[model samples]
Target: MIAWRAGAAYPPAGPFVPVAGGRLATLQAGPERNARGTVVLIHGASANAADPMEGVGRLLAARGFRVIAFDRPGHGWSDRLGAATPAAQADRIAEALGSLDPGPVIVLGHSWGGAAALALALDHPERVSGLVLVAPVALPFPQRVALPWYWRLAAQPPVAWLLSRTLGPPLALYYLRGASAQAFRPQPPSEGYLERARVPLAVRPGALLSNVEDLIGLPAALERQSPRYGSLSVPVLIVSGDADPLVRIEAQAEPLAKRIPGARLLRLPGLGHMVPWVAGDRLAEAVADFLPEAASTR
Candidate 1:
């Protein structure tokens, strides 16, 4: 099989690990022995293991933590495995972690992946010791924002199948650069982000379809899952950019911090949705500081 980087000249960052329906691609870093703790990185929509790996995985690894960034279910090199919701995706990730036999871990999830992290912490509590949510979309927005017509259309399975084979790839390729720019609006993307993050892999027909499915399905999933946030027992740190246009801080992070008891919210001024890329060092520092407290609970 082709590597997770798809057509990129370089090799895949890590190996594929077996899970339920299929395998997941994972990029691992740091020493295996005497590590601070395992930190799992989950990327948002239209991203792969490389996104968070490049964002903060290496930095955490360098700090004496074992870090693993997974291609969430269908996103990167991972098999789709019928993970249609964040909860389902979390189960799949939990299975992978079980096989790897890593004890309870600290999970850092960005954007939509934040929802997945919340699911992991709630449904598979034993798998996650703590959470670092960056620009997360864990709760339903305060106001209803209508989705674009194309997004709604793409959400349908029949249309999605046809479009994935016919129009999706080209359309995704056409919009990829603009979308990345918009996602990082008010803050330029870190240099060489596309290549380093293997972003082009996301535009492949299947991955693009999965992205639309994940995005369109998110709101309802959050509505169903949000009410359960109060039960999470792990230490949670929410880092968000107040100026984020995609996932608003007031609507998502601020409310989430309050919903989860003892959760801490750190709002960064003048920043945007791409917090992991633009402010990875700060995030690493936050993780380093929060980990001790997280470990204390265990």
Candidate 2:
């Protein structure tokens, strides 16, 4: 695992705690003495909490929020504890929340992280004050579509090894650009935009492999978890980009909005899956607006 930069501005805010036979790396920002509420952010597949949530953390902290982000097991600075199941990840999150000072907490997750967040709310509802899902990949089983053939071919063992060593980096870059182009509306994405967008793909080691596993496993996980959606009574916000290719807005977000009673859905007409980074400020504002009520004590 890559060692965290020593004396880095964003230092580890707490001790690494053992969870599910692995250690989770955690960081916190905002008031150290007294906090109003806490927001726990979980990043998408192949990316650690820091890479995806750093901008959001800064924005939330500026708005007087205690923001906590963690590298889930097997990613970034956290211990590799094999493939982490979504249920186990939620349990670890619950444990992390317990260790924090008492306060309301809003759990926010992106993509694969959203699946874990939903699982957490279902398994430990009392720990969460509300929920926010961004470009969430959670959907019912037997995915509406099949994996692209290239993705399937890449999953093969020997071929995967070769691709990882020889063409992975460039291919990863190409895919990022291509995906961003398709997702963005009106204007074409620039090199600078692609650079920031690709950061999540670049930072994680063995990202491709992990992403493949996530795509394969998530459908079943969502199928199992979908039935319990009605049981979630917490205020929920689901954000999705109408143009998002990675997750179909109509197929996933539309049904989810209708299913979760009183769930608020924000559909950005031309936005893409990279909305968190591409429009971080707007996303932050949405969260800020939604949080005030959820933050208030019931």
The model with the greatest lDDT is: 1
Candidate 2 lDDT over 1-298, as tens digits, reads: 2212212323444557666666777766777556667788888765666645554776787877788887775564566566556766788778766766445588889878888888988898888888889888767745446567777777777876677556764566557556556644433554455333224333233655656666666777777888899988888999998888777788778888888988999998887776676677888888889877676533
Candidate 1 C-alpha lDDT tens digits along 62-181 = 999999999998887788998979999999999999988889999999998999999999999988889999999898753237368778877899999888877777777778788889
Task: State every prediction's TM-score relative to the real structure.
Answer: 0.95, 0.80
Runs with alpha carbons beyond 4 Å of true place in candidate 1: 1-11, 142-146
How does candidate 1 fare on TM-score? 0.95
- Give lDDT for model 1: 0.88
Among all candidates shown, the one with the greatest TM-score: 1
Model 1 RMSD in Å is: 2.1
